[model samples]
Target chain A: MGQRIQSLRAGALDVAPILLGVVPFGLIYGVAATEAGLGSLSAFLMSSIVFAGAAQLVIVDLLAQNAAWPVILVTALVINLRMAMYGASLAPHFAHWSPWWKRVGAYLVTDQAFAVSIIRYEKPMAELPKRWYYFGAAVALWLVWQCSTMTGIALGATIPASWELDFAVPLTFMALLVPSIKDRNSMLAALGAGVAAALTSTMIFKLGIITSALIGVLVGYFAEGSER
Target chain B: MIASQSTGVWLLLGAVGVGTYLIRYSFIGILGRAEVSERVQRLLRYVPPAALAALVVPGLLFRGDNPGLTIHNYRLLAGLLAATVAWKTRSILATIATGMSALWLLQWLF
Candidate 1:
């Protein structure tokens, strides 16, 4: 139990600084929700229910435009398709946990939490009880997200568009991406994904991410085979 | 009635919430119990680089609807610089700080 608490604290500590980056975006989301005509309750509900920064922002943006419901749903789901990949990648680490906890754990699987947890788990440590670490990251992110969003909603529209805060998302991902490309095949995958994403970004319903990611995976796999 | 949003909006909320949860749960719930092959495992391992690249590139390339591919596209330039910083230092703070500052500076200049 003491070890579990320690792992949890470690997880939270690992993700704490990253959460600071998320707060500005979360506050921005709250303001966006209000401007989109969503009241405080629904705004808060969106934050808590969706618990996804990018997807929640997309939903609110669509709502403000009064886009078709199905459009909103498909677009949001496309944005979230990466969640499945994250879960699959992290599955081996938590294989010892019960099915119920796995379900709960999945709910907390944000990009940030998954990034930190997977790095921790991928290290060859035996019996480390890593789920607690994931829980710490996820729970910390959840609370900060909720509070910042509520604050943004309370403040409302005061966040100027001039800040270009949206750029933070890509900046964070770039930092994550560089370290992940640690090999030749992975390098090929990253390049393929970037060019493919840029080329196909004009696709309908925002299918570029999913499409490019698959292409990248295939390129990497095939490159590995070709090298052998 | 929830926050004066229309019933349609509530429906959207429900559909998105349930759909997203299922996506998050799918593999975590099943992949552990099932036997996995090495080939499939390799593909899964590639997910991080592929997915992150997909997310980062288009974001830097576009500003809203426009394709900001020109030299004037401050984000693309700043993103390139940040990518270099990330590669060299492997530091998230420096990458983001350099990227955001580069963007703000270029925008202020031009």
Candidate 2:
């Protein structure tokens, strides 16, 4: 129990800083969802159910635009494809766990949680403690996300339209995308994808974003391969 | 305004929820010990910047419902400023602040 507490405390403490960034993003999502014509109940529930910030934002925007359901689903799924990679990366570390525990752990996985837990797990550590730490970090983030999103939803109704809260959606994405462009390959990938999305913005069913993303990934892959 | 809660919206949300969970659970629950190839991992690394860029680019360039690119589009200019801040500070809060403030200022002036 003492060991569990220690690990849990460590996980929560480590995740605290990341929550600083998440809180604003969550709030923005709540506001955006409300502004985009999603019901308050739906806005709040989507945050709990979807729990993927970027995808949730996209869904709300697409819904507002009256995009078809398949378009919304495909776009969201494509945006979230990275989570599958995250699951794979964390698999080896969690291989020894029971199926039930693994299921619960998988639900807890988020970009921030994975980011913190992986760094902690990389160091030599026993399976049990590492798992406990993962839970700690994941749970902390989960709580912050839910609370901040709720706060945003509650405040959403009061926020005037003139505030242009909708712009927060793209601004948040900019904040997220800019830092990840650290190298030549990633830079070229972003440039390729961004231009594709802009040029194809008129495409039916919002295929532009997905196509752009695929092109970016392919470009980045070949660029990296050629370098090697 | 409570957007009309359509059965379609609920179904779409349900599908997204289930699909996202399955994606998250994929390797962790079922493929625990399976090794991913190096090529796939490299591709996954690019997903973040690429996907986010695709999402943001159109929003920055296009104003209102139209897809035209105009110099007077404050979002474009403000978004550029925000990107510069993000590049410099690597901070989410800073980026949002810079972008929103620039947007408001531009709107007021223009």
Candidate 3:
């Protein structure tokens, strides 16, 4: 029990900094959702239910444009496809967990939680206490996200359009993406997807994002293979 | 104000919620200890950069109103500046501060 508490505290502490960056994002999502004409209840529910920042934002964007349900669903799914990879990467660490524990853990999985937990899990002595650490980080992020979204919803139109809060979305992505471009294959992946998305930006129903992501992943995969 | 929810919006939200949960549960629940194939692993490694790049580039390069690349696109300039800060500092807070400030400054000056 002591060990569990210790791990949990460590997880929360580790993720505190990342949470600072995410607070503005959650707040922006709330403001954007309202501006997109989402029902306040629905906006709140989406945040609680989906709990995936980028996908939730995309849903609001598409819905506001009156995009079809199928298109919106597919676009959100494509944006979230990265979660499967995160799940796979973390599977080894979580293999021995009970079914109930795994379900809860999976629900709490976010990019921030996954990033912090994986680093802890990869350490040499990370066998038993890792789950608690994961929970700690996940729960911290969950609480912050929920509160910040509510704050944004409450503030609503008061945040002034002049602030251009919309830019926060791309800025957040750029911050996340730049750090991940460490190797040549990763760089190529980003470049390829970026160019594809730019070229296809005018495509109907926003299928361009899905296409560019697919092309980028394939390009990166082949690049990795060639290097070996 | 609570906007009336549409059936299509409800459907989209429901499907997204289910799909996202399943994606998160994929390997954690069903696959358990089984090792993922090397081929699949390699592909998964690129998911982050690919997906993020796809999301970011369009917003930076193409504003919805203007709908094309232009020298006056402050977002593109700010995003590039932020990317540089991200690479150099590797700090999320720093990147956001620099990007947002750069954007605000450019908007003011230009």
Q: Rate the local accuracy (lDDT) of all candidates.
A: 0.80, 0.87, 0.84
- For candidate 3, the TM-score is 0.92
lDDT of 3 by residue, A148-205 (tens): 9988888776878788777777777777788778799999999999999999887887
| Runs with alpha carbons beyond 4 Å of true place in candidate 2 | B1-3, B65-68
Considering DockQ, where higher is better, how would the candidates rank from best to worst?
2, 3, 1
> Taking the tens digit of each residue's C-alpha lDDT, what string does model 1 give over A1-228?
888898889899999988877776777678777767787787888887888887787677656655557867876776676687788787878778888888899899998899888888877655556778888899998999999989988977565667775676677678778988999999998899889999987776666667888898888988888987
Shift in Å, residue B107, candidate 2: 1.1
RMSD of each: 4.4, 1.6, 2.3
**How displaced is residue A33 in candidate 3, in Å?**
1.5
Clashes of 3: 0
Clash list (residue pairs), candidate 3: none
DockQ for model 3 equals 0.64
DockQ for all models, in order?
A: 0.50, 0.73, 0.64
| Pairs with steric clashes in candidate 2 | none
Q: Which of the predicted structures, 1 or 3, would earn the higher lDDT when compared with the native?
A: 3
Q: Taking the tens digit of each residue's C-alpha lDDT, what string does model 3 give over B1-110?
A: 22345665676688889999999999999989788798888887888899889888987887556436777888888888998998898776787788889989998997
lDDT of 3: 0.84
Pitting candidate 1 against candidate 2, the one with the higher TM-score is 2
Tens digits of per-residue lDDT, candidate 2, B1-110, equal 32476566778888999999999998898777878788778998999889999999988876365335777788988999999999999888899999999999998997
